[model samples]
Target: MEKITFQLPDDLIAQHPLERRDRCKLLHLDSSSGEMKEHVFADIVNLLRPDDLLVLNDTKVQRARLYGVGGQAGRKVEIFLVDKLKDDEWLCLVRPGKKAHNGDKFYFSAREYCEIISILADGSRRVRFVGAPASEIMEKFGRMPLPPYIKRDDTSVDRKMYQTVYANEGFSIAAPTAGLHFTEELLADIEKTGTEICRIRLDVGRGTFKMIETKTYEKHTMDPEEYWISEESAKQINTAMKKGRRIVAVGSTVTRTLEGCFQSNGEIKASHDETDIFIYPGFQFKVVGAMVTNFHLPESSLLAMVAAFATPEQILTAYNFAVANRYRFYSYGDAMLIS
Candidate 1:
């Protein structure tokens, strides 16, 4: 853990997305040779080969953060839905947790309310919706779950800016940030180069924002995220693997989904499953030949995975170069290509 850790200035963390997504910076790193090159994100089209299989996670960010008044005194409460446990029930993290004891009711609108059914060991609440369906309530009153690091409230602009142009399903709490850098025009351009693009879904969970609290990386546990790969996508990926084409994962979520679904027979299985696959230093990657990812937080599991993809020393060196060049950091920041 210490080997992969580095110092980052606070101001370098990107507070908002750029006006044009693909106009951000791109740092290309040669994993084996430790060579680095800098370019604008749009230059990604020029970096790909005709035989590259570009895989993207199409999981969309849901409007999961809601504000309501609850408790005996009508104090304000915040409900952040983490996962849907049933049709009308969800696992959530509540702000002012003490005000939301079991049986307490919260109102999102005149006709929408929910009751706290129970509290989990992790202090998250099991909430049951009443008067309306959970999806309806969230769609009407919830805000995008912007990361705490952004340090601002979600605005109407975030509905489009925070999500990728190709986002297809609303199950994830966070955007696949690397995908956020690619515009529709850029995708079309990449396809024009004969780089095959495929999609997979990974319902990114709250674990994306979780930090490493353990002293050692080995002691840290990852939260499971649900993922799915269609038979069509499986055939495309397997064909690429058999032909020895480069499998370029769009983000860490896609990287995990692909590597996790790899079978002992050396083929990707098409199925829906949950993965708590934590890629750290010393772990072998089976599926991803290259990666496109946003700059991750210091000491985060995401950074650890990048280190594993390359080397801790090489990653640290490239990170320092990015910092010295004043490249942005975090979800809405610049990107890196480790290949």
Candidate 2:
């Protein structure tokens, strides 16, 4: 993956989404011929066929970012909820790591407090909410978990702008970005074209936004995230596959869910499970044929996964074209459709 690198101009990073969601730029990549074209994201409906199936990750984004003071001396701490362990316990990434040691106490409000009980192997803290369940505390105080690259504070607009129109189940710290471009009207229009829509859940965790820090790609390990494919969704997907219809994943998370649950016989099982699947250039894709995704960070796993779908050469070429043409990059940015 070290070879999979790019130079992203600082100005290319989109700090905010366009006023109109579907108005974002779309880069079309033809995998077989390696040709590329630019169009508005709304044109996605025209690019699909009647026999195509669009799979979406409907994981809802939780308000996982928190700002509060901790320790007896009242030091500031930033808590990013990573996982919920139980009703009262949660696994979180805390700033000032040295101050969040075992037995440390953090106060969110006068009535809501948390105490670190143990340390996880990955340096995340396992803490117990003292005054209320962790979920309730977060609901009352947590802010939208915006990516650090956005360079702004979370605002009231983020509650709606950061979420996809169809998002409804599972708690994800981050949004399934490609879905962000779809409006309810656009989805209805897509359905009228006979392109069936199916859904799966993959809770986007803290690791999804982190850049690759290892010297070699082999050292990168994905933390397991929970996912589920319903019996109904499996039936629709299997029926489409049997008929030779295309399965178009909406984002990298959906791609991960489809590939992780795929069987050798080309069938997807309906069940809830955790997957740490890491995709790169040479991995065989079992379920997804096409995908809708956002431009990702350089040297990131999401970029590597896209590289696998469309060859590294094609993906990088398209990216260069995007940069030259001024397409917005990152979560609140433009979209790409590869087939």
TM-score of 2: 0.96
Top candidate on TM-score is: 1
Error of 1 at 124 (Å): 0.8
- Estimate, for each residue in 291-314, the C-alpha lDDT of model 1 and write its tens digit: 999999888899999999999999
Candidate 2 regions with alpha-carbon error over 4 angstroms: 213-219, 263-266
Model 2, global lDDT = 0.89
Give me candidate 1's TM-score against the actual structure.
0.97
State the lDDT at 337 in candidate 2: 98
Candidate 1 error regions (>4 Å) = 1-3, 263-265
lDDT of model 2 at residue 151? 96
The local distance difference test score of each candidate is 0.91, 0.89
Candidate 2 backbone collisions, by pair? none
TM-score of each: 0.97, 0.96
